[model samples]
Target: MRFRKTGAPISFIIPSGNLGNGVAALWTKKMGLPIQQVHFAHNANHAVVDYLNSGDYEPSDTISTLANAMDVGAPSNVERLKALYPDFSLLKRDVAATSVNDASIQNAIRKSEKHWGQIICPHTATAATVREQIGESTNEWVLVSTAHPAKFETIVEPLIGKPVEVPAPLKAILLNPSQSQNISPNLLELLDALSGPKV
Candidate 1:
């Protein structure tokens, strides 16, 4: 959409958990979009970065981080990426991967509020940190903001020293009652829960 609007090639720094969004960006580029590059931003669980550094794909146990949504170590979309770009060099060319630690994420959150006056969530901070490390580049970099800062107030508020105002839509949704089902870590339990009576 940015390409359609600006008619200029742009690059994206996506916050990825299971490589789903990053792979979709690659497909968008493959379909002849004017995307110059697609960069994957990950938290401590950086399986994609591991694969990019080494020509091997290995899934590890996920590490808990501020970016809880992006704490996926076994990214499901890696096979799709491999299918899209079979050659390792081609894959490397199409995608850039980086990992940000908890300290970096916190620092990025602070820097964002200080510089841009934007209180970004930890997931977005991952991409912001990568963008900061890259310095200024000719390519237009879009850091994908996955979630609102209000969703992570426990983490964001203390860092920014203020309350992140929840948007109207989010506030309305929050007013509605939330429902959840707790099940065991077994397949049958999940199946039973899924097939159980509707609330």
Candidate 2:
């Protein structure tokens, strides 16, 4: 609706690992937006890179990375990806997906702070790096920065060499008394922890 007013073509460059936000953009495309394409930016763990480049969409174990939330090996929205573009060639044409490593992510953060004077999260940094790699384009790309910098202060602050002020709500929550229970990565351990009997 908004774009209809402006008369400009829209493109989305999203930091994707799970493909949820990408799917949302697809939905917008379904709604008849002039969606040029959607770019998926992954960090080190290039789980979906093969699917985009080739026609093979396989599931792999997600490796731990800076953008941990986007660490989905078997992206749940892949079916949507297939449904959107049943043909590999069409998928390749419409969707551009790539990977960025930890080093590149850090570099993006530093460069953005130095040049743009804005600090972005590791996940968002992935999109920034991909944007740079793609070079100049006539279309304006909207990068979907999934998380705020405040949420990833430890990761963002060190990379940018600056202090990120914690927001009021997060600060209050952090100031309050909170307890966390560490549990091994198993259902039994989780069950025991939830049951209040530490084994």
Candidate 3:
């Protein structure tokens, strides 16, 4: 859609954890879209950046960050990426990756609100931070906004110094009771939760 609108090859700086979104962009490029580069913007959890830069796939423990959605140490799609681009050099050429810490995420949020009057979520801020790092370029860069700012009020409100206004549709959804549940990563715990209360 952005390609059609811009009428030129565009590069995407996507905030990724599992690398699903980044892989999707790569597929788009494979399909012959006018995509120049598919850059990944990672938060504090930087397994992807480390792997891409070093050509060594070493996944460590997950590190929590303001960009909670992207707190993935072990990206599930990396194997797919490796399969798609077997050569490390080709993979590096096809994709660009970088990591931004919590401080940068906060700064991105504050700067966006202050300078552009755009209230972006922490996940989006990671991509925004990367875009700042990349600076101005002839190639059009699209920083993917993963979620609405209002969805992350706890993190974003304090940074931007104001409450993010929830969109009408999101507000309506929020008014409904949440059906989410918290459980450990253990399969037994998941099975128990799915099985419901004991008689």
Q: Rate the local accuracy (lDDT) of all candidates.
A: 0.92, 0.85, 0.91
- Note the residue pairs that clash in candidate 1: none
Clashing pairs in 2: none
- Across 1-199, the per-residue lDDT of candidate 2 in tens digits comes to 6577878878889999889898888878878878988888987767689877667878888888888888778888899888887877877777889899888988999999999998899999999999999898987788888888888889999888889887798889889887898878999888887889545
Tens-digit per-residue lDDT, 71-183, candidate 3 = 99999999999988888888888799999999999999999999999999999999999998888788788889999988899999998888889899988998999787899
Give the candidate order by descending TM-score: 1, 3, 2
Of the two candidates 2 and 3, the one with more favorable TM-score, higher being better, is 3
- Indicate the residue-level lDDT of 198 in model 1: 65
TM-score of candidate 3 relative to the true fold: 0.86
Q: Clash totals for all models, in order?
A: 0, 0, 0
Candidate 2, run of 10 with poorest lDDT:
190-199
Give TM-scores for every candidate, taking all chains together and pairing residue i with residue i. Answer: 0.87, 0.83, 0.86
Model 3: residues with Cα > 4 Å off, grouped in runs: 1-7, 179-199
Alpha-carbon shift of residue 163 in model 2 (angstroms): 1.2
Error of 3 at 192 (Å): 15
